[model samples]
Target chain A: MKKDLKFYRTLFISTFSLSAFTFGGGYVIVPLMRKKFVEKLKWIDEEEMINLIAISQSSPGAIAVNTSILVGYKLAGIPGALISTLGTVLPPLIILTAISFVYNQFKDNAVVNAALKGMQAGIAAVIIDVVYDLAAGIIKKKRAVSAIIMLGAFIAAFWLDINVAFIILASGAIGAAMVIYRERKRRRV
Target chain B: MIYLKLFLSFFQVGLFSIGGGYAALPLIQNQVVEINGWLTMKEFSDLITIAEMTPGPIAINSASFVGNRIGGIAGSLAATFGCVLPSFIIVLTLAYLYQRYRKLTVVQGVLEGLRPAVVALIASAGLSILTLALWGEKGISDIGSINLIAVALVALSLFVLRKWRPNPIFVILGTGAAGILIYLNI
Candidate 1:
């Protein structure tokens, strides 16, 4: 089970293809990654994929890229992580750069302008779908604490317009506090 | 100098962007729009739309696009590197230690706390974009700010998403075409 040159190549190529083809963000890429790495390549197992998913979700980056880094690290090492990131990132960077060149011309064109505006609406709808999907998952779990945290976050952002960083750190703090409280309660028992 | 700024600002984006890429939006708006004034609210919304349609995460695409705009190809590379560096280091380090970290009560609690918060951030990002697209930057009070065509497009797009559930790229492209037709009719 040597992770030779061929291994890194496969790591780079598979992630490249995954990032290149997948259009939507986190929700789309993570599952596809599992299929490719676990189901197809047999590079990692189901539990490993699940762990990677959780790590990627909690970590501070694009879940897509983060997952790529995990699978790459698991397979190879630091170099694997670097190569896989290049694979995942290159597609969007290349495409967006090309688009930028013609962007000014496209920006002012009537058809393009109209289409872009329409795309905004479409994008909004997509965001709605993401929201619904995530919310449904949370609700299905039926955790009162989670529900309260979710609502608190919504209000802080939507109504108060709080900075998101503070919200995240604060939420993390609250979670840490919860653990401490539970620990004390268990000791008392 | 410009490259440094591109690197630093995006480094901040990468560092603070928790719960995934969409959660980065508010922070991005703050840096690119409010702090640096690199792009307007309108432009930022457009950035999100384009990034959404593109292949990578919104944070990376936006960094590339903005960095390119401000500093050229070097800027693009710099900003992209800045955007990804934190994730690479953090995720790689965590991946190894995660087996142990997952068991810690504090770590478990933090992850749990962040989940709902992440959802809120994403939902809020969506709401902010909806607000921007529909009513411009005026905090939603003025009915006059509403663009009827954009509103119409919103309903149509939502229906398409619910009914067909096609690849999002196609839906976005279709709406853009519809946008052209609306302008043409006018």
Candidate 2:
């Protein structure tokens, strides 16, 4: 694909509209992106789209932002990446600005407060659901190491009050070490 | 100073929010609620709901809302930029490297290890939110203080989730409506 103004315009519009409209979370935007770029625009191939999604998931930061970066880069290099990010980010920034303004206005309203109080419980439930699904996924992998790490992480975060960044960094280091050790053992074998 | 603090706080959130938006919750809570006292736990829960109801990434939405609360549009811009900057740099570098070297098994391994930790962080965040909702900020000092309505809402939400598996947005909105009805009368 040619990296022209039109191409950049199209890229920006796609990411902007998708980010603006898609609700739920970061994961919800992936299929929509695949449809737009892979199926609709033919900008990216199906296989490469999957790879991009995997990379986005594995990398730090929001999946939507990361995927936009890779897709933008794949299609039009660095400028593409920047345009896509700005597109993806602008919608939420605008929307939330309006929302926070209104929210501040009604911050102390009795009706709004009551509704928010109830929503709080709902949000907590959603978080619990997420925790259950993620924990179950690790357990289902049937890897003792993964299971142990999950337990250890919960204990450290919940009970020990360890800083989360340290936990994540330590987990990543351990993960890399385990992989290196396994690779060496396989070579020896 | 507040703008700088907002930028740095969200910058850390963006840099460390591996996995996805959900994983960022605990880190964001730590920054906004625990360390900065910018938002109480109750307000933080409202922030999550607002993020859910709105479009785009939770982390992004949150930075904007919190930043706007602290400063204004300029503050929102500062925060939103801070949240996106790390991802922009990290992804650009990783994408360049990925094209050169196809084998990234170590990244996979790190993700694998990170998965469990992500779950744990999410769980810890959820538990705190749940505790705050049910027992209030004072904590479980007495049975009389427990908010049975909040507990019931959580149970109802979970039941609806298990049975229908409806989108969480509905559940959140439904609970909000329920709150209005239940509390308005009282």
Candidate 3:
């Protein structure tokens, strides 16, 4: 909690390098972060690291950004959060900028187009796998409400063409209501 | 104006992208493709491929990619900052409040509900892209126009994913190579 220049520097570098080299996205960064902060730096303990990851997943936006912010805040408060976030986002910003330029140049080329078209099919397959795993995980829990909500959401988006923002809001409300109702019934009993 | 529009569009993506990066795809699709027409369906799919192969989060890679396409470097900066701002604010606030109250039951319940909904959203997005990849926008109506190669690639990709469970980056790379070899002649 000293909040020194050296500490901030180290936090920025640690986050920057971890983010720059890591691929696959938010989930990939978790173990690497643990290796660095919890094991090498000993800045945080194992238990706290788990808690941070949980919070990151539950919160909105990217998990990597959220985890970096939490770790930074835990170490040095608000400024630390800002520094860590900057470090985490910079690499992607730079990499994609160059990529976009090259992509624009070759985007209309038949070969590049063919390659991307092929990749699209593969991407679609991956997305399907993600959908299956996520839906199955919820259904495996045997929660009727979750299952119904999942089906309703798919219909609403795919057929009715409803805005997803509204669906998410309604689902969150239902969840909170379920908890509140259960609490009330317990009290009455 | 374009910069501002790009910023605001991605700002919404960041704000409501509950669950994680994949969960945000449908929302991003809505903003950039559906509403704004900034990128065509093909371009959007290409963006996903690039994002998958790249080193950072999908949301950030998307913001940068879509922004660069629309408005150039300054636009990428605008969109990336927009994407980052909400997370910065929300996480900082949650971190502060979490210090005061370690438990957050309401948030937990909300996440429980949101989880199923997020899964649904991803499924819907996947179906749309799949339809485009195999059948194009006419969907099933244009059955004769369907690309057999795309269908084969999708089948092969899914089989590989289910059996080996290799890293997605490798799967995508392999598929890209397959595309080059298969389509180069035609």
Tell me which residue pairs clash in candidate 1.
A114-B179, A115-B176
- Return whichever of 1 and 3 wins on lDDT: 3
Worst 10 residues of 1 chain B by lDDT: B131-140
lDDT of 1: 0.84
DockQ of prediction 1: 0.68
Query: Candidate 3 docking: what grade?
Result: high
Indicate the DockQ of the complex predicted as candidate 2: 0.79
Per-residue lDDT of candidate 2, residues B1-186 (tens digit):
988999999998999999887999988987888888999887888888899999999899999999998989989999888888888888878766777765777866787788888898899999988988899777678988889899999999999987899999999999999999997888
What is the C-alpha lDDT profile of model 3 across A1-189, one tens digit per residue? 467888889999999999999999988987899899999999999999998887777778999999998998888878888899989999999999889989878988998877887898899999998888888899999999999999999999888888878888999998888877777899999
Fnat, one value per model? 0.78, 0.82, 0.81
DockQ scores of the candidates: 0.68, 0.79, 0.80
lDDT of 3 by residue, B150-183 (tens): 9999999999999999999998888898888888
RMSD of each: 2.5, 1.6, 1.6
Task: Order candidates by DockQ, high to low.
Answer: 3, 2, 1
Give every collision pair in model 3: none
